[model samples]
Target: MGRRLLLGMLFLLSVKIMAQEKDSRLCLGLNYGFGSEFNNTDYTFINHFYKLQLYYKLSETKHFQYEILIQPEINFAKHQLLNFYFVKPETPDYQQKREDYTQLKEVREYVLNLGFLVRKPIGKSCSVYVLGSIGPMINDTETERMSKGFAFADVLALGFSFKMKKIHFDIRPEIRHVSNAGLSGKNGGYNTRNIEFGVSYSL
Candidate 1:
């Protein structure tokens, strides 16, 4: 009787493993979003972004599972503002323009990024995640650029992942904050936010 019981247990375990394997999924995807930056001194700028990625899942179904994401992105920036100081006595009409001492200008930037993500499932078809990355931006202006160096930033991303049989997709509304982050016309160290959409195919 003991031998029979052991055999039954092994059979059950085998069935469970097969079920999991049949339901497992792996995916590759593309992402697109809009982005912007805000300087430490309150100057503001805007940009749009795009990316391509590879996504992977290690389990079939779980309240929590491990995730891996590799993505490359491109960001385009514009509408930059530059500020300075003008003392009341230094201007032709110092007192008249004293209240408007700062100036605003338009500029543009291009940023390239590479990122890694780890995610946890919060719902049947959704997950929340966080990411960290370092990259560079080639800009069209000076003071607003990456100090002629590489740009660095950290981003927080939250979104839902969806699966249909063996196929899956992900979408995240993300907020990114950078220190010493710039392209060509805008300076580094600012807050940026964007909404991203990604679609994937599992192997």
Candidate 2:
């Protein structure tokens, strides 16, 4: 009787594993972000981006699922400094620095981010998720807050997704920070809040 009970337990475990099988998918979307007071800085920023994503099942349980994401993004941003911190009166170029840092400027960025997502199902076709990612970025314009070259972008988001047939619609609210990780002397970064809408298909 003990042997029979052990065999039954093994069979149930296998069935549970099989029930959680998942497939890969692709997603595309746009994101618009703006600076918020959470950064402890006076500068304000705005950005819009085109996003491409590919994701697959990494793990699962009866109550949760995990996914790995490869996402590439291209964005344009507008920035303006609202404080005198970047311009010190003691500096030789104080006048020039003040003139440069206070003006509105447009910048472009290229990014490739690797993300990990944790999801919980609400029903048959809807779920809530949390996602985090960090990746390399290339900035095309120099600013008082950051340098003009290589940087890192980090993101954390909370999202909801609804699936209809093979199509999935998502809404995500996120916080993002970009810095060069001290690769250069000017490492002050920009922090922003972003809302993203996206659609994905399962293949």
- Top-lDDT candidate index: 2
Model 2: how far is 167 from its true place, Å?
0.4
lDDT of 2 by residue, 4-118 (tens): 9999999999877665443333344444344442554578788888678777777779999898888898878888888866666886788888788899989898999899999
Q: How much does each candidate deviate from the true structure in C-alpha RMSD?
A: 8.8, 7.4
Off by over 4 Å in 2: 1-41, 90-92
Give the per-residue lDDT of model 1 (tens digit) for 63-166: 45655555666666554434434132654675544344234434344455556566676665666666555555544443333343455555677777777765
Q: Best candidate, TM-score-wise? A: 2
Judge candidate 2 against the unseen true structure and give its global Cα lDDT, from 0 to 1: 0.82
Model 1 deviation from the true structure expressed as Cα RMSD, one decimal place: 8.8
- Model 1 TM-score? 0.60
Off by over 4 Å in 1: 1-26, 38-41, 58-62, 86-116, 122-124, 132-141, 180-188
Worst 10 residues of 2 by lDDT: 22-31
